[model samples]
Target: MTDPISIVSTAMAEDTLRINTIGNNVSNVSSVGFKAQTLSSKGDVHSDLINNSDGRLLRTNRKLDLALQGTGFFVVDNNGQQLLSRNGSFSVNESGQLVTSNGKFLVQGRSGPINVGIDSFSIDSKGVIWVGDREVDRLLIKQPNDSMLLATAGNYSSASSREVKDGYVVYQGALESSNVDVAGEMVQLMAAQKHFSLMQRYFLLYDGLMKNGINQIGKSK
Candidate 1:
């Protein structure tokens, strides 16, 4: 009785969540170095718990650009805490330290933030920092676990601590491209729309059947 309705309603709710995730991916299609997020449903019990996966790699030609080829994250310091990100859109600050577009200091070496004193800098393949041809600090690149979940505040939660790489590469004058595929997103959009429509039809049919049953009982009485 109520089971079917509950199933349909739960399915509809999950469909809505899927639509929202798809919408976000579509909106960020042209975002520089943006990673496309893929959503997955949890459990066979029709629950709405969804998870996302980061996919694909892209290349950008900005002199301040950076891209991580393998599984690693660039360490960023927001206030006094550390944040991790794959986005390599970077710039040199007045102090000559490499920073993100948002002005957060990029971590270098296994040590704390490296302070730069000049106006010119470059990152080599080994993530070493070059301040006008002089090696100052190595970029603090970390290889987080694959199952680690990256969250807000530029932080990540994983079973193991992040791996520091003294030899990870960072290319200046290039950016990593976004991972979203337009064709795949469009196909997902169509499927979600169809599922939504089918659920709505089922809801309507359930309503009509209940109404007819009530009307017949009243006539018999």
Candidate 2:
């Protein structure tokens, strides 16, 4: 028979992982464009992270902020590596190039890096950027064939294959709120904690049984 102690220990480890994941979700509940992650069991021991991208839109009413209303992501050049994100909070850098709020990654446009040049610009529903009367560029919005295949880090996701998605409407002066359900997470966390406690009790019970059996053998000798 398989050792009960080993089985209990494995269950405890899995519980710890689940609690940590729930904690992370709760912490990022207010992060802009953040997606909630859920752990799906693969077989008996392994699990996979599935990100939920169904977040609600928040109106910021700031011209520089942007938001998507449908299935698509804004493309950003992260040091030559293109990354996709729903985070539309952007600002112009020192060189007049549009970048993320952190002033790190450059926001990509149809031509290349967008340079607003300190001029007031407006983005239409179709992702077109207009500076005064002339149209400068359009934002790069793409949707992957399978969003689950992309690796997610915070509000950004990256994949090798990119396909331009024109089905989405871009809403300027808004952002996407995180999709984390705090109440649901709290319920799951409580269940995991209870399971962990039961597993710990089983472990202690097995240890005591082993000790008792060894003591009986010593008495016989």
Candidate 3:
């Protein structure tokens, strides 16, 4: 027989994880180019697995900022390692190189980071950088179909391999808003709370049943 306390504890832990996800979504509601992360809860084993996908775009007319119209990610150097992001909140670095808000260098092509040679430039739908007369570099873009695509920090990779769209469009002068909705999160919070309460009631009933069983045994004795 399952222990009543153990069952309750496990249920509570899962509920707590769900609440944490809701909280994170609410917190990043205003983050630029921030995609909403989802918590996938099945039977019990993979309780709080998170899924990160690109969100819908919001138009903010600002130069230096960019957003992808379809399946593509902005390449960035998070310190030394490269990272991918849908957040097009980019700006010129101190060296006048195009970079993310956190100063990560944007990746290009199949080799390394793309160099924005000029002091100013523009990007087209095909992600070709136009610095006056020269096409500097094409942005590195990828599209994955299944669980093989592992999102590390913000970069994605897979063993089976995913195809990349080297010429995807990039909208200059705009930033994508987070896909999170406060109202939706609130609804989710209520549902999770009600379910947790129901589980708690079930746990209490099981405990009472075990106690009554012991009492009946004692009386028979």
Candidate 4:
């Protein structure tokens, strides 16, 4: 049989990891385009764990900000490389080109970069970026599978299918809010703290038992 110390140790470690994840999610609640990461059991057996989940989309109506309804990401040019993001709090650069909140260029149709020079633009239902009366460019929307995107695009090599118009469209002047649930995270934090305290007590009791057993053997010998 596995010893109590070993069993409880594993439980405590897993619980700690879960606690950390919950705290991170709670902290990033106000972060725009923040996706909530999750921890789940991979199998019925203990120690089989997985950490990843798709977060729900939140809509915020703010002009120049765009949000995807479902199953897509807006492509942004971070430095010279393209990156995927859902955060749509955008701003007009000095040169009048549309850029992300952090000043990264929003990729145009995946063919080349877009330059909306001193022009107002509106995204159409088909992800078209119309600058005034002329159609300037189209946005690249992709549905990532297998893995989530990193902060940069150069190292992101996930094989994802391009998201077409399957109920996914650009909502101008709106940003996607972080999917973290504060109430849920608080509940998990409480549970994890309780488990951690219980584990500490158990560990202390197990150590005392071993010490007592060793003393008894010494006296017997």
Report the number of the highest-lDDT candidate: 2
TM-scores for all candidates: the values are 0.81, 0.89, 0.78, 0.81
lDDT comparing candidate 2 with the true structure: 0.82
lDDT of 3 by residue, 30-135 (tens): 7765555556767775433334544666667786778876665666665665455677776666665677666745554555666675556777877777788788
List RMSD in Å for every model shown.
3.7, 2.3, 3.5, 4.0
TM-score of 3: 0.78
lDDT by residue (tens digit), candidate 2, 79-140? 78777787889999999999999888899998999999999999999999999999999998
Q: Candidate 4: where is the Cα deviation over 4 Å?
A: 43-62, 79-81, 94-96, 104-108, 149-161
Question: Stretches of candidate 1 above 4 Å error?
Answer: 44-62, 104-108, 146-161, 164-168
Clashing pairs in 1: 58-177, 60-175, 62-173, 63-173, 83-154, 109-138, 125-169
| Model 3 misplaced regions, further than 4 Å | 1-8, 47-56, 109-111, 145-163, 166-168, 209-221
Error of 4 at 92 (Å): 3.3
Clashing pairs in 2: none
Clashing residue pairs in candidate 3 (N, C-alpha, C atoms within 3 angstroms): 33-176, 125-169
Candidate 3, residue 69: the lDDT equals 64
lDDT of each candidate versus the true structure: 0.67, 0.82, 0.67, 0.68
- Model 2 misplacement above 4 A: 44-48, 145-153
